[model samples]
Target: MNFFKNIIDKFAGKPVDWDELEEALIRSDIGVPMTLRILKTLRERDAWSWVTANDIAEVARDEIGRVLPINPPPIRPLPAHPKVILIVGVNGTGKTTSAAKLAHFFKTRRHTVLLAAADTFRAAAIEQLGVWAERIGVEMIRGQYNADPAALCYEAYEAADKHNVAFLICDTAGRLHTKSNLMGELAKVKRSLSKHDPNAPHEILLVVDATTGSNALAQAKQFHEAIGLTGLIVTKLDGSGKGGVVVAIQDELGIPTRFVGTGEKLENFAEFDGRDFVRNML
Candidate 1:
């Protein structure tokens, strides 16, 4: 709450500092629409004049939590083995790293897991995921450079079946939301995965860099429009990111954040908590 404390110090005992409060929030990366709504809500209260900055902070936290859903429905148990988790996002958002972290997360839970490097766009991606797979003591499958990613997904599923893996995480190539052709290719990949099981890619998780702020929300909207998103993995929150983007994404897209990347280490990731997120940001 240090950031909010600084703002409060500036406005302490000042007569009706509504503009300053709104400015502070907007600077914190809370979108304008949501910031205005929050201020309006606070102004409606009977004790608006008496509310302290800390009290306002609590109100913000509660409001964000209300819109952010925690513990969304889990991956349903199915007749098929190896629940498929497809992780997608733009390149630099740490999508590959998050995929590795997720693999580590599930492995620690004692779930037999495997990783598939469906990203043929770059050799480094395939190699990086392979290293993580080896370190996690889980097997992985990849294809030659520019190999058909959908074809690789099917082969990975077959390999997962042999290992009786409980979870198969697929790391796809990063794509710009502006590229309709790339989005179309993603649909083809989805259709290809279905060849193995009608519902193979049960979870389409979008990894986002929280530091991207409002732009991240735009990307989420575009991606959701292209391929429905089941959940989100928000990254780069341990740095300069304000963490409000997660709330905004949830508010705009109705997609719950499933996990967050806090640091560079494998253990720096964890499931999303609305209270913890807001408290850390404030």
Candidate 2:
């Protein structure tokens, strides 16, 4: 979160060097478009000749604030059916864990939550969510390895409806964003879920590693284009101080980040707040 401090320190006692400022902003992984926007604002300022490091930080925070939503609406359960949330991401992005954390998030609020181990491509994935389900004291529907994930999710919806569950979170198998076959399979899952309720998968959330920086933005673009993403779950933000991807994705794709994982523990996960995020950057 203090990553912006580096930029502030760099120009602490000197007039802002346009080239150095641009490089610093770009290197922060806020994306080229956002970096350029910040620079342009600084150049057009009334005090452009004597802008300080603090001024740079203020402008950056203001621009980022403008791009991000102050408060994205929270996910709420439907009245007649369970609200389905599909957790998706590229390999090694912590999709399963985030799904579990999300379940825990709702359960803590005293809402009935059901988990679907739809990542049938990986045997360990099913077991992993099972462990969390047990710990969270919730029911989980799982299928065998290599099973059709679309079919598995369809069945999970029926189970959720039968038990009057408030939320059904499906943790889908991780795949490379570049693979059309894998992405198509994801689209199939969305379609299968919709069979129960036209909008069965009420939320499609993409989990991304904040440390991956600009690559996270690219992944969001591909996933959003493939099946349409409703929001994002950004992870591993406790250490990297690379939360700029949250702003970058929101700015570029107009996909709001709904949640963030600050650490490995379940409690580390929480809803995203634009104002708090901008305030903590320095």
Candidate 3:
């Protein structure tokens, strides 16, 4: 956030105190574990001995980049057939919207994209995905109210092959961690994907809202522990401006962030660009 820049500005001509650095880190939502690590690095560098604030800033940016690898890891693409992706998260985290954004991204790459509305638990969720499919000009597979989510994924997989699509994006119902039955349903969806291809649900992405602050860490830990998250998509970053949470996530789970959402429009979503992101947040 701008707090980091403020720290750089305030201590321009002053010695870098460990206490003040710790306070700024906590204020920026960098978890204590990572903050302590940063402090240790600075202390070892003799940062308090004779370093300028600009020197401290350079160290800080490098430390952040160290924890977060800027390059995207090699992703498993559709191999000889369509790739299936299961997008999940608690409600209000923009899971559906991120799914649409992903569909748009794949479509732009000239891949035939298919959408599945498996979130029948919420009628609005189903409708929202349908509208996005139309706006993005992609095929959608949906079921009647109260249909089994696992069954929906199975049928969507079949439909994708029948239509000769390149990718199938399944939007699951959003529920909190308290809903064990719903969480179990998510596991079943992954299990069902094996019915068609053992690696059908090739990627499982957990969508999170950056504005939730520390709660985002909790959600990431829970979802990652529960159903093996392959990557993460964080939304609402433009509003919160809290960039430290990115470092917090990397330090906590090691699940790399793949995409970021800046605004409501479809074009607002972008591949995680660490250098540009750091500059914008500062």
Candidate 4:
């Protein structure tokens, strides 16, 4: 979205222009507290004196990279028998679509993928996930409407064990972050699944919609605090949303953005590359 070019234009080769820089940061939803911290760091080193507009842009990019967990999270292949992956997020955050794309990604890698439609609270959730499972030609374990999602998870884990699949991906129901009971329900699912495989739910991938802007940071914070997320997947980056929440969450929580869902297509999901992302933002 020309994120870098816009930042450079705002700088205009100015000398320590806090107003312009602050506007860029705020618009990017870096937040006032963190934005000021970065600005203070820049000012203390007299960066504005020697840094040109282009140099300032580079510095901005570098600063983002530095604050973020520069090291990428390890993408482990199917561990042992079924490497369980628990996917969670609020409604309208592309949780279902991401699950399908991820399954396709692993299927292309030749992993025996098993999808669990544990979002029984929403009938459409099961149908949607089922559609993707059929499309990918992978097995799916599901339950009836408003059925016990935790039970569905348990069944899926058992089925994965019985079939000896390479990976078991559980698609949880979408609920708001503010709903404590719903979040608690997710915790229950994790605990229930762990009974079958202690090391199960190897990865808790929290999906965040890039268009949500700063709200993405809040979602990450809430989800991480609630369930100890292993990584993040930002969706809808293909649209004009700035997607700067990736920087905010990385800077704040250090939870790596493992994947970015660029578009609606199955191939749109990609591994989050720090170097390419920096280049894109600049």
Best by TM-score: 2
Stronger candidate by TM-score (2 vs 4): 2
Best by lDDT: 2
lDDT per residue as tens, model 4, 157-252: 889888888888899999888888999998999899889878778999999988888888888888888888989888988847477788888777
Tell how far residue 104 is off in model 2, in angstroms: 0.3
lDDT winner between 1 and 4, please give it.
Answer: 4
Q: Compared with the true structure, what per-residue lDDT tens digits does model 1 show for residues 15-67?
A: 44788788887776666777887888778762545656666776777777678
Please provide, for model 2 over 74-193, each residue's C-alpha lDDT reduced to its tens digit, 9 standing for 90 to 100.
998889899999999998988999999999999999999999999998758889999999988999999999999999999999999999999999999999999999999999999999
Q: Ten residues in a row with the worst lDDT in model 1? A: 1-10
Better of 1 and 3 by TM-score: 3
Q: Scored by CA lDDT, what does every candidate get?
A: 0.81, 0.92, 0.82, 0.82
Task: Quote model 4's TM-score.
Answer: 0.92
**Tens digit of lDDT per residue, candidate 3, span 92-120?**
99999999999998888788999999998
Local error of candidate 3 at residue 128 (angstroms): 1.0
Q: Which of the two, 2 or 3, has more TM-score?
A: 2
Identify the superior model by TM-score, candidate 3 or candidate 4: 4
Residue pairs that clash (backbone atoms under 3 angstroms), model 4: 4-281, 4-282
Error of 1 at 161 (Å): 2.4
* Candidate 3 backbone collisions, by pair: none
